[model samples]
Target: TMYELVGKEMTDKWTPPWPFGKKPTILQLDELGMTDVPQAERVNDAIDDAKVETAVLQDILPDVGFGFGSGRAVGSNNWVIGGNTTKSGMPLLANDPHLGIQMPSIWYVVGLHCKPIDGSPPFDVTGFALSSSPGVIIGHNSHIAWGVTNVNPDVFDLYRIKVNPANPLQYEWNGAWRDIKVRQETINFGDGQSPVTIQVRETHLGPIINDNKVDKETGEIQGFNNKDPMALHWTALESGTILKAVTGLNEATNWEEFREALKYWDVPSQNFVYADVKGNVGYQTPGRIPIRAKHHSGLLPVPGWTNEFEWQGFIPFDKLPTVFNPKRGYVATANQAVVPLEYYDMLASELGEGENYAISQEWDYGYRGQRIIELLEKLAPHSIETLQVLQGDNKLISAEELIPYLGRLRFNEPELNEARDWLMKWDYQFDMDSPQAALYAEFWMQLANNLFGDQLPEQIKLEGWAREMWAAYLLMEQPNDTWWDDASTSDVVETRDDILVRSFREGYNNAVATLGNDRSRWRWGNLHTSTFVSNPLGRSGVSFIEKMVNRGPYPTSGCTGTVNNTRWTVHSGSFAVDHLPSMRMIVDLGDLTRSVAIHTTGQSGHPYSKHYDDMIELWRNIKYHPMLWTRAQVEAAAANKLILKPAN
Candidate 1:
């Protein structure tokens, strides 16, 4: 059987890819001291013997040639508010993590409304969980609300192991022989009801990925690289970190409680943005950060089997760098660079090394993050309307610098004159009907793709920068009846002027092909689609792999009139942020908390449910469904509610 069939089932029958150095097998209940051996094997063996082909997931990537466009369709953003800045004088928080716009979409929405002990007296929280988990992993608890963005910080490490030629599962940990921890788990192999068992191994460094076997030629283990820069991470499984965060969250009576709650966090690193009913606000760079030797950097993997590169200790939470309710009246996080380059010294001084407190390397803090900071800095007397505007802002100034260089082009037989004039009168905006905006966005993206083609030749394969300029330009320009009868990207092969024509040809071609030739055929909503599929825990498996896209654009407004989910385009980027928001309970936390969250898809994890796809239209239209938190709220939520009492 193929190793690819592993982990296809969600049962007590399996174990995770462990890093604790303990790999075990799926023991049949009968063999584990159960009295009924025959009955146990009957249920288990039937699943193990089903013959099925393992060719479904052999490719390294499902789609290789077409690079992601629409400018970072796969990133997330967040911002939090503390009590010191709220009208209610209580803290309030909000966040929206952008990610690769997947088909069976990654985020799931749910709400918890019952009263907890004596907390927030019947208040409710509406938020999402990462599909597999049951509780609201990110949401407003009761007294406060929190949002998270993938830290995307580098946190794991892989060690290149010297394998014993005879025993592949064993590798050298430190000048000595050490066997990787091995564990086996059963999975559904697709044919009939049969399941199969697969072995998993973890070395001193991490799990054996790739083919579950070392490559004979490179001697390298595949997968998350048990020897790469990320294998060393175990934050997700760290009990201290997970328990501390959860217990702390349970006691959070206000913003301060929330801060203490974050102290026990581990795994799936995040940027904590918070706000409470008390008008308090705060931000925490949450996660277990390893205190490594000053000589080592988390940017990439380091050598293992040696003492040189190792985690020194863990960082402390009290000293973790965070921004409390600043008198400035606003705080936001977008997984962007929190500290600007120029302000590095200032950040260092105000926040101390606090390295003993864990930091994350899941995502590097950079550009888009910093841009969000800069955007927030420009707000005046911040209002919900202003925050909404910020989410969907599509004004790219870089286009102005490149358009003039195109020299001569013809449209309407104006022979470069009308074309130039059209561009000259243009303001770079992706307004739905704006032709100049569309053409400019596309052209700018094209010119950029044309310029940087051969920079990184060997290491990686990614879409070039020049292509981005072309993509940004497409929003403004569309073809017309004149000098060019829709120039197909497939036709151009020469430099427009010392520029790499081939790359732009490809980038331009991609943009042209996916979106139509010119203005008349171009539509941002058409290209910016969202998919919602159901994987049924791990049982149904990732939605037939082929039925990935169940829905398309939902009258979304991104790229121009809106950059994020606005009142009109909530589906593409929005989520519910507060209960009793926008009406009676407006705490005046400015517009930050009341941003009225949304997503391009729905709340159900079930792919076939009508409610699963119902939210799309509401999201596209910038509308919201009342988040039910109490019994009355839930009852109102269900036009059809069914209560099933357990049979005695």
Candidate 2:
């Protein structure tokens, strides 16, 4: 089916076939399930292969979805400009990590100060830290400040394990039958429920996460059937010195020390943007990215019996994408591709001639990254105030990319034409109060659904960011492409124009129906809103408990691809913002006292506490609290003090 749409060459190239024999038929796209077809697989000759490599990689890789419960896409924006481009003649670093919006919030804002003991460096860092973690995850010390955006490298892989049918506990590895490691894990439900114990099977590669499926109705485990099980080989499984890296970063004084600290940072790769008191700006992509065999692209499952698809080793930390004081004066990353094609080539030359050096194929579209760079270039001589405003930018680049196609379409109905004309004149900002934004949002969702919804089944259908980008690509570059034809309408072949006109009419009608016929009353804020939900309690479904735990359906701005990334899914047919900047932070290297930050919710976990929801309004209003650095500033602002003396 993919071959029919994108042709054999493009399909084969993008969604590479199973490296073993015939590809296995998968019933569902489960975590341990085999790859069926890449999500939103496409063929666009006009776009450079290097540019689309990440999207193609995403398509081919099995979509296990975000490990977190959220269906929203994971992305963030982080950039640092050199002193030359800053008004204060000091680097300015800004970061807003897009994550699930919650009540207590994922970030725990705290200032850690420790006097040097045993001739060790004093810990005087201040910024966001996880309650469970020991040190600040992202922040600055006396000498330097840094921020991070996820790299989303292809560090995980699935292998089709060949089990010896005769001996269920044995698997075929390198032509020899080897014993599969089995571990019994007992999950204890401490609330007086019976404990359940299950067997976890593991091959030499790693754990077989889907060794057994559970029956939904009975809540019973269904053991492996005739089908071969898949084992996960992820970098996270390896014992990493991540804590060591964190502590090293907390104490690091300069660029060289910061890099040395990152050497121990393995697993869950991130693009670390750096700025220091010395007026230096830098970036480093540090992770344990696996190097696959020459034949494997890390796209689909391969036979575990042979070493052909096995990872040779990890890409060395030094060779990973790194830049220091570049000629561009700034380095920005929004989960987009960090390196050029030549970087891979250089790796191939250094590490063996034919080894695959794909650091990762799963990267976000460059809309946010492109937008950040554009703003950096356009608004030179940056300051903390300007950088804070930049963090709240709500311009949707995807709308800009797709709206031109609407202009080219000639609609028959007068109402449709009026709507089309209105959209054509829009500035493509997803501002909360903009009526045009509401109309455009509806039209774009309908257009995407009309274009590809018919072709893709409900189970594997494209949604949200991926769907938006793919639809835009097809409309812009491949107008007459076969994907334009609606599979449901068999009588006549549909062209791009035909689909556009039909979708536009349907979208306009749907918008009017939902938002009332009076278009002026329609506001994007009415549809796009954020609810800060408390975990377990918020999901309890009891009205009173949910009301106490959950925070607002607050009017929000921005879409999936904006710098102020308020991500929502169109698959659910609701514009309720799910993923957003969990925390916004701007570190003014010029003045550490001027640094400011705010999370979606508040610092306290207690719902009744005034500090619990205090930050919500400030966050919604794009305001931030000062990251007080000096002891005098901290004492001056302190309302209450609980000093802890050494218990002797």
Candidate 3:
């Protein structure tokens, strides 16, 4: 879908950090051997394959609905620029990783100063860390500041293996029968009933994920049949250096040290952007990217009977896309392909014929990235305040592009004509109170349904790959491209105008009913509100505990591509934004103490604690709090402190 929209030329264009002019393929990168990155099955693929059991699938959901896998479609935006592009003579960096909303929070704010042991300098770190971990996943120290968004490369692959009919425990592997490894785990129920035991089988490839049950009578495998057993091999399972790598990162002093530190950083590979007070900025993707054996791309399930499908080591760290201070002055990424096209030829050779390896095949549309670049290029000398404001910009550029096409559609209905006229004068911003934003959003949805609902189901059509720019391109460039013709209506081949008029009428009538007949009341915030709920409990049910923990129904702005990517759910066609920046960070290299940041919920998990939802209001208002770094600033801001002494 992305290829159809941007075309291979623009999608594969060469970017900075790639030293050579020559296009390199995955095969070429594999020759260098990078060796470690986080890996997960693309969630869509996992869903479509239907091999994942409902129970395991539920685990991914408590975080994001259907967390089948991590892909670029639902990711983040990050960028860094050199001092020349900044008002102050210091580099600047910003990051906001979008994820599902939850309470008790997913991030922990902390300041750590590990005293020097022996001759080493103290490891002074600050900023947000995963609530479960100690080291900073994205933060800054006195010398350098860094942030990350997922580098959603295709690192996980599913394989279909042939299970031996005579020996159910054996599977065919590279021309021989390989025995499956079984591990048993016992579950305790506290009550007197017997504990349940599960037998998990591991193949040479990885884990036999499809087999969920064993028949008690005959011992035959149940859920996933033996004929087509599915095994999942992920990069995360094989990589173990992430802890060490992140630890190294927390102590690194400069770009070189940071780069060196990342070599050990593996699972859930991320694009790391860095800026130091020394006036330096850079971007590096650190992870293990497998080189699929010839004739096999990682997009789908491959047979595991032969060695041809095995991975050939990995793409070396140096080959991972990296860029130092470029002449262009700024580096930006929005989960879109950061690698330029010049390197495609070399890498293209690695993929099968007619195949393209997107940095992450599931990347979101480039609207956000394009918008960020436009702003950066326009405001060359960026100030901290300006950049902070820019991070929350909600200008819907896609609406601007669509307005021209919509203007040309002929409408007869008076209400439709009036709606069209109103839209023509509308500002392309999804600000919370903008009625125009509501109109455009609803209109776009209806138009898309009218155009493609006949050919594709809502589930597939609404995916990021099919809905964003790809649909925009079709509406603008190929209005009469047969796709507009509803296959169900064979009586006539409907033209673009026919579909547009029908969709406009539908959207207008719906908007009137929902927002009231008064056109002025159709505010985006009325429908597009954000909610941060408790994990598992959601905002609704939780054994009578919803009132104490869940937050929001708060009005918000922005959609998938805007700087604030708060996406609403499709349920009942209501606009309850559930996905947005879990945390936002803007680093001021010129003055670490001047930097500002905010996370969705608060620092304390206790619902009664004052810090529980203190930051929620600020986040809902698109505001930020200072990231106090110096001891004096931290002490001044500290309301209470506790000193822990060693046991006597």
Candidate 4:
């Protein structure tokens, strides 16, 4: 019966698939119960491939019910500048999707086995994807590899429609007139499932975003396609599913095929990062990009029904903009603006330009991108291992100008001085034993809270605070010009100022009281902790905290916003009920032909089993083992494996 329904009122009836809306399934338990990222089954056999889209996900619900747990679609950030590539010489690709949710995690860690349908050797396509979908969502097969981070481009716009009181169906468009399209879908909730009905309307631009009437108490956002309603014609609606395209690409044999697969990329924009077994790397803006004439909807909503503001076309792939592998060896992106002003001028004839204030407003990409690039450039002999370490580095920081003032606090209070001794005696590395790092971080946050109660001030925030005085301080401290390059490369930088004596004194007092005046009491792991929860049917909870393991790699160490971070937890959604990304992997596609991989969880989401939450302890510990490479290996490494043949 579930298979019988295809595109049958999906947007209204699909209630989203998950057990008890939170637990993992039996298949999930079979695959994920492990201490490391599992290797693919090295089988010499192959089976008839199923149409993944058709066979894997069958939304049985009647109406187009929102699939996202929080009713949110997607979120992530990634960018690949023109600098880093392997050999074939292309712009490196990178992406990060910030899908908001709570618990178990949406990402599935899988290493699928495949025997080329074309009569080639079978190899594993290791990657991550939604559990229901088959194929590597973000990983390398043998020929090509890729990753996705959200584009976070602003595409949806609200319009305030001026409706005809006489005929509610008609609204004025442009200077002339037009009638909006109206439609309705009946939702069959099933026998005793409570059938329902839903009303939907559309316009030339897109769907009616808000309800026809506004809620006085709730301030609910309503939509009607007048010259003034939220008109949403995102690149996602017209294009292909990024997931499907990626799966197909995993089976691709060459770049031409890979690019062709990318051509189908649908909604929810992404900055793609690609690396092939051939060492060819490339980046692409892989979503439908609107070619708007004049800039509108920056400050306020634009009027719909106006022909003056419809999207003409999308940016073509070649013209979508990219820089291939540069002479330089490394590239990085943390969601910063891809194009500079000069580049924009070269692209559009009448580039969307208006209100200088609106133009200057920061478009999402904050200090993270700039920070990642600066750090990468400084580390010349860039290796993947270094990149991993960089992800978790924590360079000490504070107001540069205030370092001296901060230094004075230690002299002022004996208790504060104890904290300073612990901090001063250390290199700014975020080692688990480095109690000073935690103390410093806590103090920094406290100082931040004191200075900027909620959000940091425009110019004087921690980010700006470091840069302004850095050039001057670097010139003075080392005085060598090369010092600038070396100093800048660090994933993090140390601040030289201590303007907040009160914060120092306060934190010093708190730190000493808890940690004791002796340096023995000043470890960060003791203070800084990670809280994890298990939310099944009704409520949310937390049983896991920061684990202490002074071994191979660190946990949540290094720098915040640094490229290499051990503490990569996908904690998203409302605090009362959150949606967390279940897995975080650091894979190694050695030569892209065959490789090693590791992820938090195995291949499932079912609870009450070994694999369900098995990866939790391993992930929390920042320790991983080898993936299963064969049936023998899997049988040996895995707690157990089971087969669930789908009933025909």
Q: Model-by-model lDDT, in order?
A: 0.43, 0.76, 0.70, 0.43
Per-prediction TM-score, please?
0.65, 0.90, 0.85, 0.64
**Judged by TM-score relative to the true structure, which candidate is superior, 2 or 4?**
2
lDDT-better candidate, 2 vs 3: 2
**TM-score-best of 2 and 3:** 2
lDDT for predicted candidate 1 compared with the true structure? 0.43
The lDDT leader among the candidates is 2
- TM-score, cand. 1: 0.65
Better of 3 and 4 by TM-score: 3
- Candidate No. with top TM-score: 2
Residue 330 lDDT, candidate 3, scale 0-100? 72
How far in Å is the alpha carbon of 229 misplaced in model 4?
A: 5.3
Q: 355-432 in candidate 1: lDDT tens per residue?
A: 211232222213234344556656543444444555555444444535554543433334334444655676655444
The alpha-carbon deviation from the true structure for residue 143 of candidate 3, after best TM-score superposition, in angstroms, is 0.8
Error of 2 at 340 (Å): 1.2
For residue 434, give model 4's deviation from the true position in Å: 3.8
Q: Rank the candidates by TM-score, best first.
A: 2, 3, 1, 4
lDDT at residue 416 of model 2 (Cα atoms): 85
